[model samples]
Target: MDIRNRLKTTRRNLLGLAAGAAALAIVPFAAQAEDGVLKGKNLAYIAFGLQYEYQVTLVNRVKELAAEKGMSISVYDGKGDPSTQTTQLLDVVSKQPDIILLNPVDAKLLQGGVRKANESGIPLFMLENLPPEGEWVAYNTFDDVAGGAAGADAIAKLIGGKGLVLEVRGAIGSGQSEKRYKGFHDQVAAKYPDIKVETLKAEWTADNAHTLVLDAFTRDPNVAGIWAHNDEMIRGVVSALRQINRLKLAGEEGHVPTVGFDGTPLGLERIREGTQDADVGQNPFSMAESIVGEMENHFAGKPVAKETLIQPVMIWKENVDSPDNWGNRVN
Candidate 1:
């Protein structure tokens, strides 16, 4: 079978196992933190899937931090199923974890789960994308809108504020995607009015992005730059450009400058090779570390910020290895 199919199958298996384990276990309130470290302090990490490399990195970071703090982390991979996530949340709620770190499939649909956790007197640390509404102990998010704006601004600067811009948006209903799109458009409207924007949704996938780019280029040949919400989509966008032998054709004169978010290895490689223009890197490792700290503080009856914002780095060849750069720290 193909890679996608294999990935899908693996995700299904993981999800099934996670759901079953959660159901079988009847966890009781084991123990709370004495000093800084919480012994047997239960924490639930509910994710959509472990298929994505970012997700794997982030989850592993959480596990690492938990191990350091003497906390127990029970994970739930929903296998891209919202219903399964809801069920898992219910199971996690029954276990009565001290904290619930959630990355929801749909922000709006997760309101009930958030509410349930809250009603159970559990602190919630929402990572990355947020729910549509409700209060959590901490809402950790990157300035995706700013990242998008920055990416767009970078493109505009490269083209001297005048060019045909092609935008590769992420999946619909993804709060980060929406924010990124808004940021990009807002920047374009303010800083580069001479530049026209044409957007196509890539559904947050490289393959979809490739297909979308191909279609966009078919209609508009003079697409000067491509700004994607995620690096995965950016890779797809580049793949599409390369496939049509239009990689050199889409630039200002003859080279299309591409910018993306999530400074993943693939995107970094492109940046190193002088193909991808820039990427916004959010340090998931640091975020995971912070979450553990907050959880420890909460267990110790100390105050923690209800909302935490992590500054993202604009990564390029020049700043790739700078002290402030976010490398493979997620590992």
Candidate 2:
């Protein structure tokens, strides 16, 4: 053990330690690079329609998230037409994007397209809607049934569970619309026996809802409350009431309590203004996150849940200002 040999041994050990540390650091960076599998991936999102504020927000959030992840996304508006959506889905499948995200206007009508995507070997992800027959990597959607039940409970409480409440229903063949209608009816039947719901088909449009509400009020002036499947339809209800001089703020005498689904900015604003009661809110931002996360998982060869249901939030005047409410965060 000479002094020179001892010095050489110590220096060699130090070099070895430094090399090990450098390799350890490289490991993490390599893993991080692997985790970004979504980068440069192409995503095709077939939205149910961009006509509604909620759908628009959902599409925008997805786009933003995709951009952040260095992924590219193409969005197609279904225009609220099932046949058109079916055509678009087929066309998108032919393009052979890395992934396909479908928000169907009618689940049944889109099953063929879903099958086509499956046959093409393209991974399919569903948002806010699901078809009976399909092979989807993951499906992310809000609990429409729960949202409807919440709306029913809110309206029943406001109306004292005894009166003729008008229900502004959405499109006939839409799965979400059907679920909401069933949930509202079932909840009312099970809990609020004295409440009678009169149905009006609005097709998820403000003008249709406005016309229907005006006709209903003309037929019966004693309608107690209103529950709409969406905030857009509620807007129609508001205009019709105002035109007839029946609109009143909450706590005012003869104020008709209103409950709506989809916590759009208008819904939150009305809640703040005391013109609306409650909104069963489906967070589009959250839904976008869930779906995009699942897409990343699929690309990374990680396990993904077959279905993810983001719970609805009950937003009322008391909590409309909460930052967590998607309505408040929308640009």
Candidate 3:
């Protein structure tokens, strides 16, 4: 088989093994699971910002799961402020945690901070986003570019390759936003010339997305589709559509076909309810586990890959009920 097929088969096999192992170990670990929490190890999670509600879920999931690995997690939120994030990095450097898991707010702004951490000999894990600068010990995130491309391609095909699209992007300068924008732009520009694309920046929060989407809809009532970089933005786009009475414009056959990333609980529900067309499902809970696993390896003096790009799956109404669908979501 070709490399792409080989990689697909390998990923499928790994998931199957992980599931089988979990099923078998559950009963035996019921008691020990509580006692196996990570202890006596300190790790720092440096974030680009923590304005999204999803961050709470990610934080809780990681803390609950990482505890079993005997590690304590501390969070330094940048509050969507890159300068503050930089300061937070300096603070983390002084404290010198065994490892740092970062979700950078601004990819470029965090370059210096990440470099400093690496220079201090502390292992750094960039989670769900990348720095604008040098490489790190390990980088864990969904394939946002692919997610964006898939989302846009779906919309283009749905609209018969002709329509105006408004894309609500995430925080400016963040890797997620950049990659997703490029993916959407690249795919549509290359394959669907009839599709017109307009981009707008959002704070990566639902409220901001709602506001921007609403205004865009009012400005351009003929917009045939919408795409958001993340779930929150998708939700915002949907909400704005509902408010402006445009949600009904693209129903079933002719609906505007909205798409998003992260496949959060809200995004999944949107698909089930038939309001959203599709979403790229990413396993953040698994990502959290992987982060701790890498941290453990770091503590044990093992080499970690410089970059780890997790695959993203597309979810649609047809396959929303499938077992595979649940594997990509957190809860």
Q: Each model's RMSD to truth, in Å?
A: 5.6, 17.4, 9.7
125 in model 2: Cα distance from truth in Å? 0.3
Ranking by lDDT: 2, 1, 3
Clashes of 1: 2
Weakest lDDT window of 10 consecutive positions for candidate 3: 23-32
lDDT of 3 by residue, 175-205 (tens): 7778888888999989999999888788687
What is the TM-score of candidate 3? Answer: 0.81
Clashing pairs in 1: 251-255, 251-256
Q: Give the backbone clash total of model 2.
A: 0
Superposed Cα deviation of residue 169, candidate 1 (Å):
0.9
Report how far off residue 310 is in candidate 1 (Å): 1.4
lDDT of 2 by residue, 50-69 (tens): 66778777877777777778
Work out the TM-score per prediction: 0.84, 0.89, 0.81
What lDDT is reached at residue 149 by model 3? 88
**Candidate 2, superposed: residue stretches over 4 Å from native:** 1-35
Q: After superposition, how far is residue 197 of candidate 1 from its true place, in Å?
A: 1.1
Per-residue CA lDDT of candidate 1, range 1-331, in tens? Answer: 5433543554454455344444423342223334455777777888656655455556666765666666777777765556787888888888887778888766787788778888888888887767777777777767787788788878887777887888888778877778889988998888777999998987778889999999998998888778888786876877797788866522335788888888765566567665688887777677777777777777778898777777767887777656454443421
